[model samples]
Target chain A: MGTIARNGWASLEDIRDILYLTDARLDAIARDVPIRRWCECFDLRARTIFPRPKKSQAGVVGYDGVAAADVAALLIYLERLGYELEPLPLVERLMDVIRSNPYLTNAQLSVLWYERCRHKCEPLVLYLADAARPKLAETRRLRTTTGYTIEVATSADGTPIWLSASAPKYRKRRVSTPETCLQCGYVWTRGDPDSSAAHRREHKKRLSYLDPQPVVELVAAVAAGENTISVDRTSPRWKHREIYRRALAFKREFGYDFVQWQSDKGDDDPGAAGVLFCNAQNVIVGACAFRLREYQGRSWRALQWIWLAPKYRRSGILTTRWFDLRRQFGDFRVEPPVSEAMQAFLKKMGDESLMGAPLSSTLPER
Target chain B: MGDMDPAPVDVLNDEPHFLSEPEVAQALERMLNEFQRETDRGAVLIAGEMVSAQLAAEIRALAPPELRGKRINELLKYPGFLSSFSARCDVALLAGFIDASAHRSTVVLRRLRNDAAHSTDAFSLAVHRERLMQMCSLGSGVAASVSEFAAKSVLDDVVYRLKQRGMTLENEIGRNPFSSAAEIFEHLSVRPDLMAVLDERMPKMELAIGVWLLLGLIVHQGKRRRAERTTGDIDDAN
Candidate 1:
């Protein structure tokens, strides 16, 4: 391929070489006075579409310079379209459009012709006429006989502002099948780029949200001052249900072999009452459930499970809340087979007496 | 011409030979096949090291000047703050230096490196074949069958991108009008009243004075650059 000039401006000969046009043919096209006149009237040199003459040859310069890309696009359009239509009139109207819209450039017109009009069977004059429409020229809406409306809008720099074709939506719907993401359960249509991209974005988001590490950090960082609120069944049933769902999810994520709350149906289990720690966003970050049991004719609330986002643990968040729990439940006992971390926490709390004896009968079946 | 012994019948063999297009293509293909055969632990270690180096460069570029050079080395060296590959990756992601996909690929690369280094059994690409393939696919933006060639290409692409980002950030930093405390003070000295006010109130609090002056100078430089850019855009439109 021939190289464009470093200055971004090309001579007529250079343009002809890049376009692979014969010298005689380009000469014939350039001889048209209006084309040269339009070039001169636009002061193409001032716009860097043409190189300015050296100081010695200032006023003597002719229409020898041009932006190669813009001129190439224009020449290609002319060569391709001139055979079907009257070349002079087409050039005049195209120049008129260029002259009227300051933002419209020959380069943009060339792109529109090549991308939208070149392959179509429609007359080039009709397309040019639509393009010449005042104000509406930005979005050239052409309704084809085949029942599709093609809209072409050009940006200032020759790229499409937006291109759309109003085709039958039902045709695509009939041909495409919907695909469901196995991990996130997001459903989107196959072979549709927008849908596939959306599915990918949503899938990433869902994965990140489910990743406990970041959430634990965020909750830990924000779990101070009035940011966290403790909720239970007494504090709005909906709040309790939402926290209960998060608690279950956290349990499953922690790889618990068996969840105690899974046995209970819902908030209706009067024997079950839970406390949930929520962050400023009202998201459940820590939770614990207690079950009332009569041991030796004395009723006591037995701790079924206590869970906090890992980062929030050992931060004195739970220790401060212990007194409140003691006042509310009166007597609380933890189930046996406590984890080492929990045992350490219990030891720190001076509540080793809260540990209960192992009850093999109450254990869920594996 | 024929009288000079036909110029000693020179064979003209000393001229450099250039490969033809087809010859070059064939040579590349052969090289790719050879690269594909490198599925051993050595390749994983090399890939891990290259990625770590690129990420470290990017972090250096994005870090504040105070954190560059020795301070940054202190953080990234063994037994330092961000010594582990995992810690570096996490810090880069949190600092918005790399996106989630790149971070995930780096994580996968780190794990592969670990398995290759620490495993007692024979270590090869097969150890974490699925994860390696996924990382390559994400890095290269293509879903192809696994090969060491593809893995190397993906790593090359990642390193190239990080290097480019680092260069761009360095260029932007270089463009700042006041890059040092001395330069900032020199610029501020033009306004004697401002300097006088500081001189009176900033005797004991030298650190606070430097920070305040630096912030003001940065904001002023930013506004000036933005205005110049806007004017250039307007001129282009006109």
Candidate 2:
């Protein structure tokens, strides 16, 4: 089979040459995964070059019946939950978990790691105490309400070690700020044996708010510019045409006639700025698309873009460019901005709608 | 060359190929079958503890336990309870569950889903797709473009609606509203400012959605007002 292009574009030969699976492998894949469901969810056209299992007289069951379905569902569920299945970091973590428990299966180790994470608040020493066999003689050990366990010990010189199973690289923690006892309002300062009792009594509430204001200042560049708007195709939000809706809305409200497409073979003529500007460096903004002529109807021009950078927007540069456009194109016959709100705002600012010009047949799109 | 058509290619090419509808449908059927199989056998049941506790108490009460702990847990793992399936069902299953209280949300959701379902019909998905295509200006393959756009829209709309209602629900509980339009906007996981920051920042359609949100907020606020008034009256009487 011909090699298939990863981008979905392929010649007829390319389609015919790639490794075309027989009906059996396709059947296996289809039977095992919700790959079709996933494809449909993402609006992809999928084809199975395979056969499927024949329907049997099985009773209608809800969410139970097959392992294949569960795995497929799990894959999709993980995707929906924003879990990066293919991320190297996650794979590395999974490997680490497996290595930590050499005897545990991947699934069991994963479950244990997740379950153990739930007890993150407990100190490592306390965990050691719970699991380790206690010494016959009384010794310093961490204890919890559940029970006492063996604790890691330090040598006479205080090497800070855990010798039970010998996990050296994984264990490295130092008490920075001493714990404080809330009941008596005493700090566990001066690392002494007596401070452990006080440390056990302290319980400080961890504080975190949902959304906080940004610490960095938002930067602005130039305000009003008749520049074309370009966006990355792979942008998460733009992939769904959200920006188109917003741009259309902006046009409708500001009374700008935005051309959906440009002529495939047009010259360097500026398409339109929708709005005009009196000054070039700092111009008032306009709403939609615009077309212009500089040399007495000879040089047909169009200002093709509107600057959308934050720096310009915040400083009201776009707004100013729009107002300036009115003055620059006052002599030439140009479509006036006709958004009710825009008109009112402009009228309030003493920019009246031209009296003699006929309103265009095309209405500002909503 | 004049009369006969060209011969069809024999081998599959290396180019990316999307599955045909029939292929997709068959695959879905097979997946459903497999799903049924995995769920049939008992899995690691976690919610069994709850059932066991209840069963223990019932035994002490001199009553026979209704079902085994495992049986109760088996019921909870139904696809309906899973968050991903729940989201799908929210839009797909709404036609069946629509009621007086949820009618409005359901109607809006149905319309959005309808738009999504008929995405290929240019006229239907035009409004949504054009926005993504033009804004993103993807130079990649059409399938990739569509996939990216569709995926983003699903999450964006879900999170947007959830956060919006979540904020309202939270405010009803006598807490400071930790959410604003921005938070909901962020929850949509898209830049809120970009909608207006386009070179030709047009907000007419957005303004309509804004109007809808504003109306919803007004009603929500009105409910709060009535609630506050009743509490104030109670305080005054006391």
Candidate 3:
């Protein structure tokens, strides 16, 4: 007796194991005595199993192995009998159904049998009739609801098949094509009036998010040669919630996974110090955040996140005031995975001492 | 004819610290040696291009057999996917030929190279000193004027590290580099048209820029296939 590999080819003994049939019973069935001599009428040996050499023992052998496809076909044909060993003429009819739709796998056949064929005497005719009934009903419903005419034709065996579905004879409205904004990455349909209006609003909103308008004092300060302002978590100005909000937005725009500030955690450290850069028009075009950390008994100012508006970039706005920043935040160290633009800026500074160790190195270990 | 001449004051008395001929010669020699050690902006840019070209070659060699035949020059030239040095570095990192530090160094070098090439003003270490510092560490006593040398050293170190990493990867994979996701799927008998659709959609999803995600997918698929094989299951679900 051969054992079956899971999901692999099954021999006669394996099939007996699956069906819980005794060797005597399977042999009796195969010999065409039981199950109304169905196996004999259909010639199961000719259709079901093709002989192949055993995989375990090669060379000197007889054709003993069965193919998975042949095993599946046999299983599907036997499944029509259900739990009852008493066989019916339905074996040939199921074989005809399998021959017509050869692509249906054993799994699919099992599903179909369970859904519409199980416990029925004339499963094939009933299954075909049941499958076509819904499609015909759906066609009728579609014609009535959608004002479209659908044609259903029947084959010689009376299985209804769809011919075509056509719309009513009326001019169709053209669909709107989707358009994307190159600057802000906004996408909207072109021909839709409402969508176009929404796109305009979204475009303005996204631009504002990228380049936030500065407060009145900050604007006045920019005009007074005080273009940049630094505020730590402990600073009096930090009491205002607006700066923190803008900082969070800038952090999000900078692609940081978390926008929550360290100060928000209520740490004893000074938390983050933000330096906002206002452009010539007094718009807060850029922001840089730093954490004042004590490492190895020395204060280290680590750069957390830095971002500038797209237009104000490369204008030497940050570079010109770098010394002032260094003076304010002593021993500045940039975080790792530094941006290429920042790398260029660091190079432009021409100060090797400014290239401090990574921010992680400055943090206390857990 | 008598000519009246004024007495010459001895400058040596006033300046006793004036060097002898050999001392002056030695001093001049020292300055000349220091000048030779300093790498100019043009030299740094050229060195960057050279290092990038070599790194590109090493990466190309480590690529799968299908991509190995594609010329590095063609791939790293204008309009190519790996045209920019940054892109090449990213591909090298994704392909596992170089680690993150090496990738960062390459990026720094590329930035320095761009600054050198694009700057209209005269090349000065004053401009790119901090960037060069980011790539390579200098001696504690090293003068600020020798930043160009530091830049050159960083480029050399990057080239050497990349070469070593490529060799290691080749050894680990037994000279057969891991195939890309598309190639693996192709080997698994996935339809070419489906793979083509994936290829077209992947760039739109920005997956092409960061292809390590696809590499991760390939590894996952390989494991799943092995698991299916072990379980003796026919995996038609994919």
Model 1 stretches with alpha carbons more than 4 Å out: A1-237, A262-265, A279-283, A357-366, B1-238
Q: Provide the TM-score of chain A alone for each candidate, in the order shown.
A: 0.35, 0.23, 0.46
Give TM per candidate: 0.24, 0.18, 0.31
Q: Is candidate 2 or candidate 3 better by TM-score?
A: 3
The digit string of per-residue lDDT tens for model 2 on B8-71 reads 6646653222233343334334433342232211110111121122222222232114634554
Considering the two chains of model 1, state its CAPRI-style docking category.
Answer: incorrect
List the lowest-lDDT window of 10 residues for candidate 3 chain B. B203-212
Candidates ranked by lDDT: 1, 3, 2
Q: Write the per-residue lDDT of candidate 1 for residues A146-183, one digit (tens) a residue.
A: 34456777655555544455542213334568988877
Better of 2 and 3 by lDDT: 3
lDDT by residue (A1-366, candidate 3, tens digit) is 122323344455554544455234455555544322333332333224444557885555332344433444445444432223322232333444455775876443543353344333232111233444434332222352324344555555545554333434423446779988887678899978999999999877667636455343342232222323665554333222434545566565567666645443222345666776665444566677777667677666677767776777788888877877767765578876677777778887775445566433344321
Predictions in order: lDDT? 0.52, 0.33, 0.49
Question: What DockQ does every candidate get?
Answer: 0.01, 0.01, 0.01
Q: Give the range where candidate 1 chain A is weakest over 10 consecutive residues by summed lDDT.
A: A217-226
**Model 3 per-residue lDDT tens digits across residues B24-104:** 334334433333344456445544554466456556655555665646557767887887778877887686665565566
Highest TM-score model number: 3
Cα error, candidate 1, residue A8 (Å):
74
